[model samples]
Target: MKQMREKRQPADGRRKSILSQLKEAADPIKGNDLAEEMQVSRQIIVQDISLLKAEGQPIIATSQGYLLLKKAQSHTITRIVACNHTVSQTADELTRIVNCGVTVLNVTVEHPLYGEITRSLMIRNQSDVRKFVKNLEKTGASLLSSLTDGVHLHELEADTAENLELAVQALKQAGYLL
Candidate 1:
């Protein structure tokens, strides 16, 4: 077996590089990948991410990986849709929204003890949807909506109001709107 390589970069320098990497990446960057690139352990990357977040970096951890949130364009439209559906309908709900050219930005559920808990999705297309569902299946993790009996909210964004309307209508037609 090969020995693990190590790089002795300072924590501050590593974090700056991490921020730069996230900014430059078009897609989310996995913490494991970041650790490998930085020659550090995944936990170190996680701690760095936490520190960055404490500094108000707008970083979000998605099912896919770590992403640095960007400001929405002036013309972008955003809306939050309340939805209730069984876990089985998750893929259908997400697919419908993405099919309408709306990006599923995140999901939020109200927890009895924790209040509002939101997670970033950043799902822009069917491929992202597939990966998201597959990861859930692969991990055997329950959806946050399960905590609220399949009731949750999705934050959606689109380039046009028409796209947002189409997505809302699709969810409504499916009896997912709450």
Candidate 2:
């Protein structure tokens, strides 16, 4: 068996270029695909992605693939609807929002330097919510809701301001949001 020598990228830095490609992309790409495009082994691509993320790059790995999130739309109405619950009720609370046909765009938690660290969820259906929760358990990831005394903010998507208002009101009535 031969050891695969770790070849360093040249000054042009294909890895950085590849990282930029992912950052500028609208959608996620698989490691295999990125490897093919960059003319490197999939292992190298994985290492590159990890390094990019370690350097504070905003990258998300999902079942679909890896995505580079752009700055969220400022024009879009983003009301911070506060919800508090026991960890057990997390799934149902999310189900309520998605059932109303609104997309759960992101969840936010406070960080010392960043102030607020928000992860974009983009979940729009029951199935998506289910998968998300399931994977969270499978991966042993803690819920952000666990912080802030089981209180969290959901950034939901709606066509109009009226729709957004109704979604929050419904959540409030459901005792999910304040």
Candidate 3:
């Protein structure tokens, strides 16, 4: 009873530290790096993240690492656009959107069995786009869009409605928009 309470103290403290570290980070922090800093296994860090999420923390896992969702600015505009294209066009599609001064928030797809699946991208520029495309090729992993015949939706964010409109128009011109 008392022993169990004492044992949980350290873990609770570690979770608090993890939350603080995430909040302070300007970019997503990799679990491996967090594990090394905390002197714990990566699995332990994963478990901590799960616990934090279960507590209603706004933490998201991205291709690069884990990120804490920030509140959208009052002037920010977001739009979800449907797109269909081959896997090879992913880079081009993302590049076009970012080139229009929009951030690619995430990709969503509807699976027959899973219903709706979404993954955070948090891609803000060409560099992020390059890293995302490179990771896919390096891992030989299939894009979520592959499940639904290259059909997917992207949530895009920009500073103004015009920026969002421009991004959508770009996708439409590239024949990527559905």
Candidate 4:
């Protein structure tokens, strides 16, 4: 395993390398891939990520992988909208928002003990929504809204204020806005 040590030696600078890689990626990078490239265990990559986050980097871990959340682009608008709906209404709620051409950046739910729990979504279109729903079915995981009795918040981003307004109106019409 001499060659393995030589490869892992590069990981001496891994934290910086990981940050650079995450910053350069347009999508989330898988932890397993990161660990393989660095010749280290996936747990090491997770620890490195924790340290990086502790250093104030805006790294977000999604169901897909890890992403670095940078500043909003020029002319982009972001709004945190409050929504209340049952689990069955999730697809409709997300579809309406995405149909307005807005990106669902994350979902937030308040927990009695944890205060606010936020998970990055990064869903941009119908296909993304479908994939998200499919994964949910495959995993059989409970929705976060189940924790707070169907109350949650979504951080939506759009290129225009009109789009955000449209999405909010749609959600309101669908009885999702609270």
Candidate 5:
């Protein structure tokens, strides 16, 4: 396994170093810095990041570089739920959560390598969802539904069970949550 991976030329010595640098970084770290420290090409660092993310590492690439999300805590108060609906239903579902006074934190979809790839979206209102949907249309990027066949998970937050339950019921009644 190691030999096969070596052909991919992942920064073996640099993996740990990059990880260490990432640990101390409050924000994303640049690919070049990661490459220089590892004594490898920046392209190699990119590939290494791909490998790490594939292995279930919570790394996010921003314009600056890569930011490793702090893993979800076991005692998180928010609830993660899977819902299936048409692409057209995305906005209403998101708006429902916001209207019910909950913060829609993240959305997750399965990636071939990275298992569940989650994107943080701190959406809080109908306008936010509208803006998001507009951006999706603007980018010409397909929704996660295109990948998960209309199934997606939402990490939603509220102060109490009643609030969360209200949002869930609202989604179910709207034919969003199945």
Candidate 6:
């Protein structure tokens, strides 16, 4: 992996290096930085990422950058809560949940034709919620709940069962949980 930092690696070498870097990263790594380090264009990095993902890599593109969603972490209590609300209530619902010291890991909604649709959020704080909401507005993208007419599910995580219960109670009080 150290050799990856020296200069532009060969084609095969670059892809291997990129994979190594992603696997070693504790946080998302920006494409531009990856490209610069590999002495390649951002577009090239994007293509490489696409190829990597197509090959079954659990790489997710977040607003911050690219993150590999590996399945090893601290054991936290996870709960899936059913929710029903209009798109306008998204931020409020997320804020309440996060304020209760929970991480909203993902959101899911059942689509009539497409089956279950889920989007990973990895939102741990109000700031993450704000950024997610802002990105939604900026991109003019519709929420998954929009497809299901305001019904969805959130997979929430908390370090303790108590915190998870607090988050669930808050969501219920806010009329976000079903």
lDDT tens digits, residues 51-146, model 4? 989999999888678999888779999999999998888889999999999999999999999999998999889987887888888999999989
- Arranged by lDDT with the best first, the candidates are 1, 3, 4, 6, 5, 2
Please estimate how well model 4 matches the true structure, expressed as its whole-model Cα lDDT: 0.91
Worst 10 residues of 3 by lDDT: 1-10
Clashes of each: 0, 0, 0, 0, 0, 0
Q: What TM-score would every model get versus the actual structure?
A: 0.94, 0.63, 0.92, 0.88, 0.57, 0.80
Give a tens-digit lDDT track for model 1, residues 1-178. 1344334478999999999999998899999999989888999999999999999999999999999988868999999999999989999999999999999999999999999999889999999999999999999999999999999999999999999999999999999999
Off by over 4 Å in 3: 1-9
lDDT of 6 by residue, 101-143 (tens): 9988888888889898887787888888888899889989988
Error of model 6, residue 98, in angstroms: 1.5
Candidate 3: pairs in clash: none
Instruction: By TM-score, rank the candidates, best first.
Output: 1, 3, 4, 6, 2, 5
| Regions more than 4 Å wrong, model 1 | 1-6
Candidate 2, 6: how far from true, in Å? 14
lDDT of 3 by residue, 1-178 (tens): 5764554437888899999999999888999998877777799999999999999999999999999998878999899999999999999999999999999999999999999999999999999999999999999999999999999999999999999999999999999999
Question: Candidate 6: lDDT over CA atoms?
Answer: 0.86
Please list the C-alpha lDDT of all candidates, in the order they appear.
Answer: 0.95, 0.73, 0.93, 0.91, 0.77, 0.86
Model 4: lowest-lDDT 10 consecutive positions? 3-12
User: Total clashes, candidate 2?
Assistant: 0
* Stretches of candidate 6 exceeding 4 Å from the true structure: 1-8, 20-27, 30-43, 54-56
Query: Residue 70 error for model 6, in Å?
Result: 4.0
Candidate 4: clashing pairs of residues: none
Give the poorly placed runs of model 2, Cα more than 4 Å off: 1-47, 50-65, 69-76, 111-115
- Would you give me the overall lDDT of model 2? 0.73
Stretches of candidate 4 above 4 Å error?
A: none
